[model samples]
Target: MLLKPGRGFFFAIVLSSVAPVAGATALAVDPMTVLIREYSRGNGSYEYLNSGTDESYARYILDRPSSPYANIKWSLLPSPDTPTRRAIESVSTQEHPVNLRDLHDMKVWDLGFTKAHIASETFRMPQELRYVPGAWSIVKAGIEPDIYAQAIRNQGLEHPAMTANYALAAQLLRAKLAATPPSLWKIRGLRHDVLDRFVGGEFMLAHDFHYLIQFLDGALATWDAGSTSAYGFRQLPAPLRLGRIAAAYRQRLPFEHEPCMEDDTHDPEHAGEGTFDRRPLCFDDATDRAIHVWYAHELVQELAAIHDRANGAPTLAERMAAPLRSSRQGWIGIPRPSAIAEVTRIEVVEAKVTGQLLVEGDVSYRDAFGASRRALRLSCGMRP
Candidate 1:
């Protein structure tokens, strides 16, 4: 994902300073302090396991309740598979292989497939046909008087995994958009394609868009409340909200520019005679609209929610500066970023040992996108 050059630089500064010493404070007084400390320790454990040679040792350490490393080990468990293996298996073996064409032929409001075996297959359908597949196929197949009469009865059934895939794809997209920054260049095109597909009557893709919009609405509501509390505002401006929504959209889609070559030998059962296209979906005309659209919207909404919540209280700037006051000298500590970059200097702006610590810093970097842009600046402070 492309992040705006300025924001990326700012993020680098915050990460370097606030991120490093984020958990240094004792948790007895500050809840966030304690949470950070615990999380850090836990994160370290998983990092060790992931990078270490012994998987069994990692599992053993995680299994021990009283182990000092327990939290990390437990937290490090890999995310559960998005689509349950059982569900996928059920759909794959179902009597009828529900393909994209099937979904495009079903009736709108026909919820029978919700319990069907090929739930995941529903995701392959086009957007306009999402709710009323039968109507769509009739129109596309042409209204021959005789053929049209039986269209409703002949509508194809979709597999349960189709529904499951659509749901999962929507979820994954939301997460990506939320975690990524706005300057990521690919997001705009991705978002545009997602919206276009939905409005253009691509029903399967529209299902994804609908899901994304719903998710965004929920996230935005939470963010708005947070903003109201922190900034003393009744509501966020419409433009800001929309911008946030867009940002969230971009964040969810993964960096799929890298080519993916599939090896059928890895999964012999699913492998076929010809070479398969294993490439991750890139936002393009040829991309699968259902999957991509769902993902993009879901991601943007999530990111917007996060930014709204985080930006609500003691803005990042203010938070980063809290460690610098003279009175809080004893409580002052380093700031940490989520990631690291080249650092030039760290400064204490304010502090009150009896109160909180504020700190700031400067950082420099050539853009991650390799534009050769250099010497960016950022500031952050933490209070405890």
Candidate 2:
């Protein structure tokens, strides 16, 4: 969550001779569909001028026996009536279609539509929504740090090709932040946003793929962040999963800045549509609360390694420093920040989690600065 945002062109490839083998480290993202979204409209209207699939990734899925990512959903497969193809059709009448051959610059940042699709206002199709695992969101950072952390956690070791780019992205952001002057250190703090361009950027920077299926699959087996309704409407799973992952990793996760008053909030889906009333938010997955704490405990250990490392422990930080990524650039490798010396880093003055709480806030959007503030805690008088 401490990484920074970047807007620059990157051109590099990491080729590998590794083959898919069941039970071996591999990723299962097949000719992935990359959204070439040019614009987004009101009323959820989206226009994707073009998109393409990575055939190599597709083959990896077919060859691999185990994978965490849901296998090629029927909708993702290329066919005459595919969503991506149909999406491009919608934009054709408005402007000339963007064909695969027409993409002259695949260096991510160089694409004409890179910044547009990265913004939340832009549109995205179902396939683009699922395929694009946002890794770098520089502009529409709903809340910078949270976005960066979620993206890191969401890199749940699935979709090897995508993970490779995330690793690269993490490294890039960290390097730039570390290089900044001390006075400007505050400018480099992490942020959270849902723009899909970050994921799209990672897709273009990918070198290859693998599938470490089933790894950490059970980490949350005893927990369920959320699920869909009978009508197929899904819920936000980040809050639920974030606490659990932090606990699983045993990271002493920080709570969101709690608001003074608990009040109503707006619904994110129908924001300007003036549909739902504002309501208070609270974290109440008590069934898994204790484990959540446990995961947070583990997470902090990894974070510690990032700040100080001698390269001996086989921990997450060490592994991240040198990840199993096939990409030329790897994990957001942490660098000694230039201003860290002058900066007052977070320190343990008096830390305790005896009856700790998991403060929850409005899901409509991140409550970062001011305005309508809200907070709800998910903790109780019980022991794990």
Candidate 3:
């Protein structure tokens, strides 16, 4: 699903609802601009740069209604070989001045342009129209299974690394559950090293394990907060409040007596060298960390369901079907596409059309003054 085209490649998204209108010609559109077109009307914002930074450009056309650059149509990715494309790409010898195309290679803000001129700068989406946050607030906006399911369905494909990490986590979870004297968790520093044998080379690949620690830290803090906290564990039935188990899992995740930085398993030079500082789980592996987090998250939900079964509380599967949301943080990212489309047919057409869609991205480009470059992060979508 990851598309990589030449410098100015076309990305077309055809949804089932708009399939008839889009016709056979898959609209060659920049996903980000499509989002801005859908939601950046009254939601856009504008802020001027510091003094001496294109006062004329800011004063004249920035927010003015008559300015074409301020218009969403003007902000779109111009069709190939068109006058608009030619004009925008003319001054710069580099890739098309399409917004956000140079994101990864952006220059630091402190280092201003080597040469400065108005014509020297390239055309990109203006800052005002690229501030769409509404797109992110939707997937979880509706009720259960609303947009959240669609997101995971679209974006949740697993790679080999992810699969291996999840397998490791599953093995560890199984071993932990089978350990003798389950009440050992009541003793804070007890070792649950049943699956420590798996903590070797392959385990080190999960670089994002710290996020699991972070989630555990939040769980502990919430539990400690008691009834006063908005997400207080005390609000839950006593059986569902897994405070001690979480603490034990946190303690057992790393070497209890060792410092994280000095842990040799995570250190490149000393990794898997059998150093005393080596941990059962390296806190830095991204895939491994995500598996651990997913494991722990689902474990807690299952435990809660088991405990609350008698009281007719929602089961783990029921909760899993619900959209991703939080009382404290509101909507969260879950569903993949956020906007869905069905491809009815494939045939070449010539006209441009906007279809229901959602795409979020960050674009880095130098300002019109050719001064410092900055990033524009936005979430754009047209919900079905």
lDDT values for all models: 0.22, 0.23, 0.22
Give stretches of model 2 more than 4 Å off.
Answer: 1-194, 201-238, 244-286, 308-384
Per-residue lDDT of 232 in model 2: 23
Q: Candidate 2's residue-wise lDDT over 1-384, tens digit each? A: 000011112222223212111111111111111221112121111111111112222222222212111122111212222433433444343334433212211111111111111222232333322323221121111113433344456454422222323333443344334467756755644221212334333431111122111111221112111132111222112222333233222112223432112321223332221112222111111112222222232333334444435566444333342332221111211132111110111010000100010122211121111111211110121111
TM-score of 1: 0.17
TM-score of 3: 0.19
The clash count for each model shown is: 73, 41, 13
lDDT of 3 by residue, 1-384 (tens): 001122233332322111011111111223323222322222220111211222222222123322211211111222433322332233233433432322101110001110000111222323432232211111111111211222223212122112222222323233334564668643632233422322331232122232222232233222111121111101211111221112222323334443223321234332221212223222221111112232333333332332224467554333322211221111211231111010100000000111111112211121211111111111133211
Judge candidate 2 against the unseen true structure and give its global Cα lDDT, from 0 to 1: 0.23
* Candidate 2 weakest ten by summed lDDT: 346-355
TM-score each candidate: 0.17, 0.19, 0.19
By TM-score: ranked, best first: 3, 2, 1
lDDT leaderboard ranking: 2, 1, 3
